[model samples]
Target: MVDALLDIAGLRAGYESTTVLRDIDLRVEEGQLSVVIGPNGHGKTTLLRAISGLVTSSAGRITFAGQDITRMRPEAISARGLVHIPQGDALFPDMTVLENLTLGAFLRRGGRAERSQQLAVVYDIFPRLAERSSQRARTLSGGERRMLALGRGLMADARMLMIDEPSLGLAPVLVDEVYRQIARIAESGMTILLVEENFSRVRDLADRLTLIENGEVRASGTVQEVLADPAVAATYLGIES
Candidate 1:
């Protein structure tokens, strides 16, 4: 039987008096790269925040690896191997690269040897991180900061990853590099739920896509399926044909 890596049903979340996410039902199976795309302020980031437990869900169930974690705290959800890398290079500016990565393994009850193993794996994936291991995070370029953010998430041996806007401030070349890295991560068999505004890139990289609009899911299907619908393109994605 194929086990679902992350399942969200009828999920709803938002800030104080602001209804952000409404009845969102999404699923990401194991070993697949699913992307979520839509126009600005369509609850894409909120969905990721909800899944990571940063934003509280007012309604519905969220199951990761078949366990109910709808109301779990952020730390608890993270410890369960569901890591989220938010849009803004959320790195501690003054912290050293190694210090930031070390924090990722803080929940693990493992010693130096285990941490060392994980760091090696992360460095293998992002050599820039290894090169600047002792430098402060703020000293790195924008793309490098993003890479470190993702590398830190991998240090958890995450079963599934939810990343928001991997291409936000990157140059064209850097965008392609980021996409390549994301594809590489998925190629290694990890499930990824990526929320991106870069539709052209998502269209090419996403195996499946779910479009959100006005805090609800307006369309969900394969990339081609969602992109082919004129209504979905115009209303949800704000893409003019």
Candidate 2:
């Protein structure tokens, strides 16, 4: 088998006095859609933050595409094509949707032609964003905002995209639309690490599934392998069969 595109081993990170992730090891192959699912406050968000350089790691190593990025600054990491989209739709609400997406290419080394090409790619995946290009981000609907956030990430030309809580706080109908866009992104050849609280929306989308709890990995395997375990099914999934 080939090496994983993103390899994290013994990753431990947290805030001042609170250690959230402990000895976590995860690997994602190129072109795979991997997901980490768990209950709230179990360090799921922190895991993505650490990988994205938002939080510092006290121990362990993170290597992406054979480069050691454990201590690289967030911007430096992003320039190398690893991008993170955190929870809560972190957008410049006052800026026009086009402005926010242009910011995503801040670290990219390219001229207007290249940038426009990337913008076209994002717009193709999310035509709604193209339609609202001149509108302020704050004026978009809940689902549209999420799509804009995703479009901005694409502007970075990311090789690996780590997204936190893509389904949070959306109506069922909107959730379906957002997830469909994510699926389309994956199909376009970007490796994805999707972090979601519940599996109902993303259960069928992951190539590998990992369950995290109390700052540790409780289970990690193919979707069927992990979901078929009785304890995981009963405790988290509430599935009897």
Supply the global lDDT for candidate 2. Answer: 0.92
lDDT (10s digit) by residue, model 2, range 143-178: 999999898998996899999998899998999999
- Per-model clash counts, in order, read 0, 0
lDDT of 1 at 21: 92
Question: How far does residue 125 in candidate 1 sit from its true spot (Å)?
Answer: 1.4
State every prediction's TM-score relative to the real structure: 0.93, 0.98
Q: Report the Cα lDDT for residue 132, model 1.
A: 100
Give the per-residue lDDT of model 1 (tens digit) for 1-241. Answer: 4667888899989998898999989888888899988887879999999898898898999999999999999989988889999887888899999999998788765788999998998888888899999999999988889899998888885888899999998988888887888888888888899998767887777888998878888889997788689987776566788
Lowest lDDT block of 10, candidate 1 = 231-240
Best by lDDT: 2
